[model samples]
Target: MRRDIFTDEHEAFRDMVRQFIAREVTPYHEQWERDGVVSRDVWRAAGRAGLLGIDIDEKYGGGGNPDYRYYAVMNEEFARAGATGPMFNVHNDMIGRYLDRLCTPEQRERWLPGYCSGDLIAAIAMTEPGAGSDLQGIRTTATRTGDHYVLNGQKTFISNGQLADIVIVVARTDPAQGHKGISLLVVERDMPGFARGRNLDKIGLHAQDTSELFFTDVRVPGANLLGAEGGGFVALMQNLPRERVTIGVFALAVADKAFEDTLAYVKQRQAFGQPIGSFQHSKFLLAELATELAVARAFTDKAIAAHCDDELSVQEASMVKWWDTELCNRVTDRCVQLHGGYGYMREYPVARAWADSRVQSIFGGTTEIQKEIIGRSLGL
Candidate 1:
């Protein structure tokens, strides 16, 4: 099972990222989990290691490579290593696109340096307290004043919410137009009336900070607007495919790691005076899991290629997102079972992985949403 999507150069970059994580991430991950947030030092280390913005412009302190494979490589390493704390995928794959592709030149000059340097952490506010996947249901509003837009809304379950210096707030500019009224405004830290609620406690991904954000008449300058007014929904639609595909990529990597861990566990754990893996049931299960992962991997690789080529369709992205995420959950659950009593213990990686994998099928558009998108694409 060789992947042709990456070149030798990509492998080299992957090695560098792996080493960086070992040095900068793994040692402090447990402390971070206890702290309920990652240290800003890691973000700065990522910037120094050239891992923050591979696709951003070089003049702004980025790697300047538009190739998306670098991100896939990074995602694979992060998943395989069970590193879920750093919200790099959200930054580089999701928010970075909006800033890199949709921002005005002035905005880039103002933000890209810190963005690429990791001095300014970014997050996009899309999901509201009431609106999950239904963008048309958003009630957040940003009304234009003499020179600024008055923003008032609350965003929940926001990744990197507590640490973000720049939040791209999605709000309605034309309340009468529904989805067409949506717009993106950059709300910087210390903006009057912009407040963050407590970092939420979660079942898993304990190292990653999630929080609720409140904007009470937060005045955002006109220059902070991202893209054209009333164009936020369209912009989101265009960029969501990338986010979905990245989730799928993460799914495959986690599944592969789970399978590998289970395989190792079964071969070592004895049953009836012999390795459990020697049993027909365990052997077949391992074989089946491996085969399933290979099939999904092939499709995910194709999706990544299509995305890099700007040809990945929404339907195809949905298909992979749901399929791989579901597969990750199923495989991880089975892996936990195969670990017997040990899997139930929090000390085991499989136990933690089980908890961490649960959210994949729900976030980045739920599995039901993905299916609906696919169904509609098929003219159902």
Candidate 2:
């Protein structure tokens, strides 16, 4: 399917992203997987390549391009290269929206520069040990004490946890207020009593660092609060649609890459007397996958366009996130099966893709959670 979502300029940017990955990412991805984290140098390289903050102001070292297609291009190229080590999407699409939209002028001036420069790594601490999908279950608390809020809690499954220089910690400001009491505090590294626990070992995404973070009576200045006090839930709600849309874009990219790889594999691998793709069943399966990919690409591109125009609703974003991630997982699993025994071997890219794709349906809100959101929106 011909995608009209991107202009020539976007295609040009995609070329740069592809070259950047070939040079700085693909070579060291295996080492990063073994190390359980990516190198800081790559982050600097990404910053230099102008890939860190596309939507941020050019004055702050960002590309100043607010178009979501630029991000979609980046995501597609990264997925194509199988470069999962760098959390550029998380930094650029997820956390960047929060900072770009909600950060006060003073906060922007203080953090945006390093953020754009990739000197400051950022993570949002929303999923605590007890609260994965349920925000109301969060136990982290931040009590006001004079000029500072005393933060104390633990967060697990935090992407970029160990490398994060600044963390936006979600805390309960008023225990009685439930969701209304939730607030966001910008917790800088080396703050008193702020500590990172072990780098967590996960089932996949070996190159990406997910870790446990603990805050024990860490005093964060009032100036560090992001948005209005007790408005954390509102802030999160505002940005989640963008995050969900971003996840959908990446999911489609992953599925497309897997399909492309499988198509090549089936043509080369012989079964019986000829290529496996010559078999009726294999040919039909390939046809089905290719058709599905085209359909998914069409929807995702439309969603991206709507998102760019601020016209995408929460229900639509949730729909895209769940559908595309689940589809990606299905496509990758089938691709692995098509590769036979070679698919299970870690040496094959499809094998790693299989492992990495498992979590897509689980994160950025699970398929079940997404369904719930959509159902609620239907007044069910």
Candidate 3:
């Protein structure tokens, strides 16, 4: 079914995104996967293409567009291209929101130009070895000194960890206050005692860098503090719905692309001298997947629209996140099954997509965690 949620401008933006991906991302993706990170040059190219900070103020070198549909279009195109290398969604959707919302004028002047231009990449560090979803469980400490906050902590599973020029570090500013004690400090690259561990190998998403970050007595200037000193928890909570929606956008796009590819494959690949898709079982499976995907697309688009309108609730975001990501995993798994033995090969897109889609339900909050949020919203 045709989606009416986007206007001509969005379609035009989608076209430009596709062209940009074709030129900048497609050729280098394989080499990037082998190297465990994308080239920083593509980031610069993305910046040049006006893809980095869509909602940031034009005075700060951004497109000055706050319409979330543009971002949705970009993510959908990237997923369809199977170009997960640059982590643009992380740069644009996740960290950009933080900087846009929390940055002081001086901080914005310092960071936004480079950030929008992709000269300085950004990452947010929240999950630690001891804490994943439970924000209250974090142990990373930040002690206020005369002129700065002394940060001491380790963060794991940080996206853009290896390449980020600036990392928004979440630390305990007041350990005595539990969740209320948390704060966000922007830790720059040359900050003393700040170190990055090896780029960790993952089950998939080889081109995107995820790593461990260490901050030992790293003194962050007080000016780098984001929002209120102990407002990190509330800030994270407010932004999480948008993050989950971003994840859902990618998940649903991947699932849709997988189905599109598999549909063509089943119709062409012969089994016992007949197209496999002609068989009753294969036909039935395709029918079911098609129905599910249509339903998911409708709901996902609705959620996107809600987010644009600033009306998306945490419960609704969680619902879309878990449901779409789980659907992505399911669709990819079945696509591999339809491909039979060929699907097991890493060379096939379906195989790679299957691996990539697995992490969707895990990150952006686990499927179980999302369900828990939904249940709590029901007053259970």
Candidate 4:
């Protein structure tokens, strides 16, 4: 199916992203996987290429384009290339919005330049040891004292954890206000009593750093507060739609590429002295998969268009995230089965893709959580 969501300029940008990935990401991905983190050089390179902050102000070293399609194009190319090492999406899509919308002028002047330039990497600490999807359940606390807030908490499974120069820590400011008590405080690197735990070993996305962060008796200046005090939950609710949509975009891209690869594989691999694709089972399977992908692409593109217009609802974003991620898991699993014995081998791209697809339904709010949101929206 022809995707009409993008213009010529977007296509041109896609070409540039492909070239950048080929030069920067593909070559070092394996080593990064072994090291459990990507080199900071790639982050700097992406910044130099104007990929780190697409929607940020150009005066701050960003591309200054508010168009979301640019981000979609880049994520699709990265997925197709099977390069999940750099984690630019986490930087640009997940954390950038907070800084863009909530930062005071003084805060922006201090952080945006380094963020857009890739000199300062950012991460958000929301999920704590006790909480994953429930914001109301967080236990981290920040007590105001003089000019600073004493932040004490632990965050696990933080992306870009090891390399992040500044972390937006979600801490409870008023214990009695429940979720309303949450506040976002900036915790910069090398602050006394701020420490990072080991790089966690995960089932997939080996090159992306995931870690546990610890803050104890750390006094974060009042100047580092991201938004209004006690507004972190609302801020998270606003930005999470973008993050979920980004995950959906990535999921669809992986499924599309996996289907393409598997289709080619079936045509070339012989069984019973004939190309496997010549068999009725293989042909029909490919046909079904192709149809499903086309349908998914149509809906996913629609969602992306809605998002670009800033009209994407939470329920709609939930639908896109859950449907596409589950579809991606289904497609990758079937593709692996189609590959037979070769699919289980780690060297094959399909094998790696299968492993990588497992986490999509788990993160960015689990599929179950998405369904719960959708169900509640329906007045269930």
Which candidate gets the maximum lDDT versus the true structure? 3
- Ranked by TM-score, the better of candidates 2 and 3 is 3
Which parts of model 2 are misplaced by more than 4 Å? Answer: none
Model 1 CA RMSD to the hidden true structure, in angstroms: 0.8
The TM-score between candidate 3 and the true structure equals: 0.99
TM-score of each: 0.99, 0.99, 0.99, 0.99
Answer with 2 or 3, whichever has the higher lDDT.
3
Worst 10 residues of 3 by lDDT: 130-139
**Global lDDT of model 4:** 0.93
Q: Give the TM-score (vs. native) of candidate 1.
A: 0.99
Give the alpha-carbon lDDT of every model: 0.93, 0.92, 0.94, 0.93
Q: What's the number of clashes in each of the models? A: 0, 0, 0, 0
Clashing pairs for model 2 are none
